[model samples]
Target: MQKSYEEILEEFSENLKVLRKKQGLSQEFVAGIELSVRNYQKIEAAISTPSLRTILIIADGLGIHPRELFDIPSLKNRPMVKEITTRNRKSAKKKTTKK
Candidate 1:
């Protein structure tokens, strides 16, 4: 299923946080790359959507490919996504059992 814009943003936020933590970097450091700390906080919190340019800037600061920020395994398999899939499967099972 196609993810909603909000979902995509949420995924990006979570992924960015994880990646930044993995690199042992602080928000202040990441934000120093062409963004104010408040703006970076908004992006990381999913309170604001970032443009492609901003994404690239952040990736550059993190020393990673911009695509890596969005296409990470953790983002793709987020807990909410898995939970929804599990619920759908259970509902389908119930329907089949009813028939």
Candidate 2:
């Protein structure tokens, strides 16, 4: 079955948000670089469909390759492991020290 245009746009928007977050940037920051706060927000919210040139501009502002924006993965739904604690590290060091 073919996907609807809205669905495709939504997915693209989601991927854009993920890429922006991965680059440690806020919408305000991206807007500053792109020179339009409203435009950035509209793209992120999927309220307005972005042109290919606009997508490329956004990707450039976010310091990512344009191809990265459309490379969304389905297996990223798994929970990520949090950082290790100092106590956990100490325990691990002790185990390794004895072995």
Candidate 3:
């Protein structure tokens, strides 16, 4: 059977864990520079998907490009765009506001 999106995310998360550990960085250290402990744990636990910013943060923490997080060979075939801007967040929030 083909893998679902969740499955692909799980693989990405696992790859990140191995990469982070290989760099000898603890989760706490990564969380400090990247994301909250709860959020980081969720990424590892596959409870919540990571955003582009989170991926960039993790990549920076690991001293690698964000694209390296993907383990699937196919994923590398396409360009991964990691766009993180405060404007996007604000626009998303604005969409939910009562007119």
Q: What would you estimate as the lDDT of candidate 1?
A: 0.87
Number of clashing pairs per prediction, in order: 0, 0, 0
**Predicted candidate 2 versus true structure: per-residue lDDT over 16-39, tens digit per residue:** 898889889888877665558888
Ranking by TM-score: 1, 3, 2
Q: TM-scores for all candidates?
A: 0.69, 0.65, 0.68
Which pairs clash in model 2? none
lDDT of 3: 0.77
How many angstroms is residue 11 displaced in model 2 relative to the true structure, after the best TM-score fit?
A: 0.2
Please give the range of 10 consecutive residues that has the lowest summed lDDT in model 3. 75-84
The model with the greater TM-score, 1 or 2, is 1
- Winner on lDDT between 2 and 3 is 3
Name the 10 consecutive residues with the lowest summed lDDT in model 2.
74-83
